[model samples]
Target: MNDKNHKVYLHKKKYTRDKMKDYTFLLPAGLFLTVFLVYPIFYNIILSFRDINIGNLIQGEQPFIGFENYQTVLSDPLFRTALTNSIIFTLATIIFSTSIGFAFALFFNKKFPGHKWMRSILLIAWMTPIIIIGTVFSWMLSGDNGIINELFISLGVMSEPIYWLTDTDTALLGTIIANVWISIPFSMVILLSGLQGLPTGIYEAAKIDGATRFQQFRHITLPLMKPTILVLLMLGVIFTFKVFDLIYIMTAGGPADATQVIPFLAYQLSFGMYRFGEGAALSNISFLIIGAIAVLYLYLIRKEEVM
Candidate 1:
């Protein structure tokens, strides 16, 4: 070959080899996701279409019932209730957690005495396992001799103890409160990072412009923190929507299904009730809902990047 052609061939060969090495590095993670994540998702989709309850779950080649499972899940009154509760629970937790977390993030962003220590102390709630947090909250919210009740009585807020988990009126609200506490630290950390990353120059300029603290936050801080807030809300909704451990530990979807969200109901159907198809169907529905939200979030992020 000519000198130039030979050099070009060698360059192409080296490029191919380097690309192969890069693929090799990704192979393990790709295989792991295919095996553990992709396979199960596809398998669950297939399972949802089959008539495979406990009776015939072990048997091979179960009958394909098509949309029967979906119809059953969609038509159920409990499913409707669970859907509503899930929406309410997810929205409530995200709103309260993000608001409280944003406040805390702003507080800690300023360097003050013991600021780091206080921030670390607040993270304890998020660091603790959700089940443990739920258990502690369960005890605290107990109608009899609970600290919450004791505090309320002491302050004359109520003459009697409020049954948080046992009452239909307060069961979902109780779970929302627990979830908000658990979620706040994560939101705070994200927002805090965003806040710390903001340009001091802008804030100084705003101060020089005679802007008040609230005016600076509303005009400068919020606009700069929009991306971080979007990411936090997206992640918070996805995580909170699938919350099962906390609810199971606390109320078990009790008090007349007051706190029966979709994830818990899916568990009840698949394992508790042994209705595999229905459970799979319910899970698939939730997956679609989350999937749509994730797609929208990604699109928004891409748009922002383009901008």
Candidate 2:
């Protein structure tokens, strides 16, 4: 070969080796996704179309039932209750938690004594395990000896102890209260970070122009914080949707299935009743819902960028 051709060949060989090395680094992640994420997803989708339950689950060959499982899940009354509870749980968690979190973010933004300590205290609920939070809240809302009932009665807010978790009307609300509390710290952290990143000079300029706090927030702060709020809302929705441990530990979808959200309902179908196909179908629906949230998040972000 000519000297220039040999040089070019060496360069190409080095480039190929570099590319190979880069791909080698990604091999582990590729395998992990294929095994743990991709395979399970495809298998679950296949399961959702089958007529397999626990007894026939391991046989690996089941009768194809097309959309029968989906139809059954949709037609089931229990599924309707679970869907309603899921919606209520998601909406209430988003509204209350984000509002409280925003309030906390605003409060902690100001310089004050124990500002760091007070802010850190808000994260305790989030750091605590879900089961622990569920158990503690369960105890705190018990009809017989709950601290809340006792305090309410002592303060004349109520004449007697209220069955917060055991009553059909109140069971979902009990779970919501706990979820809101659990969710707030995360939202606070997100909002606080967003607040901290805002240009202080903008707020000062707004103030100099005679803008009130509400006006500053409405115009300056909110427009800047849209992305952060989007993330907070999406994450809150997803985390709230996946809440099975908390609800299960506290109420186990009890009080006439009042607290039975989709995840817990899926668990009931799969583990409790051994209806793996139906459970898989329900879980697929849940996955699609979460995926929809992600799509919506992307759409909003792109729209905002265009604006």
Candidate 3:
């Protein structure tokens, strides 16, 4: 009995020591996330409940108004418009980006001359800074000297050059186009990686069974790439929903708040209009929208794993 008790005590000590060593590896990352991610989230939550505008921001005597800020933000007409625009923008970007990216991936997946070179060239869009892309596209879409308007006119699509940025009707579309261009390369790269990682043995077996290329892609390729596709779509939705720089530089959310999405709206509320609490509320609302999508994605992934 004494020998058995001694063995148990020694085993417990060794297990604890091993657990502590494993925890040490995670300490630095846990601390970094707490400081940068957790602190900001909690700070934002606190600010959302208070009236901390430009005038009182410096004085720091913000009165806690509970849900008034959120109520005001939700009730605003511009909030409705921003919500509509955000959905349209996010959906449009995701659909076009993913579709085009998949098409590009399929084409490049085949062994062909200059395929590697072409793929690298396309990636330049992703590697370039967002601000630069926005700025350059702004010039290209200009009413007078813009290449897009000029080409459209030359092609008889329109009789005259159109103002892409200053017009309310076209501002959001212009921004989405720019966003799609940026998003495509990212999706392409991800899908290409998935494509390249597919089992060669399975494909060869399918070929031996006399499966057509389309049949193989529909039955095998898509099933295998489901995880990657879901992740890419989720990333696209998240990225497009929180888009800021393109809208800010290209249209500044407007001819009349036409291009304002939630993040830019939050900026307008907090910094532009000096309503910090309302801005924080909108920002938190944006987080909720993204969070819902993320939750749904996790649920799908869990179900897939279970199946």
Per-model tally of clashing residue pairs: 0, 0, 0
Clashing pairs in 2: none
Model 3: which residue pairs collide? none
TM-scores across all candidates?
A: 0.95, 0.96, 0.92
Model 3 agreement with the true structure over 74-187: per-residue lDDT tens digits: 999999999999999999999999999999999999999999999999999999998999999999999999999888989999998889888899988889999999999999
Model 3, poorest ten-residue lDDT window? 52-61
Q: Write model 2 residue lDDT over 1-307, tens digit each, in one string.
A: 9999999999999999999999999999999999999999999999899998766768776899999999999999999999999999999999999999999999999999999999888889989988899999999999999999999999999898899999998999999999999989999999999999999999889889999999999999999999999999998898888888988899999988989999999999989999889999999999999999999999999999999
| Superposed model 1: Cα runs more than 4 Å off | 2-4, 302-307
Model 2 earns a TM-score of 0.96
Tens-place lDDT per residue, model 1, 231-254, is 998999899898889989999999
lDDT of each: 0.94, 0.93, 0.93
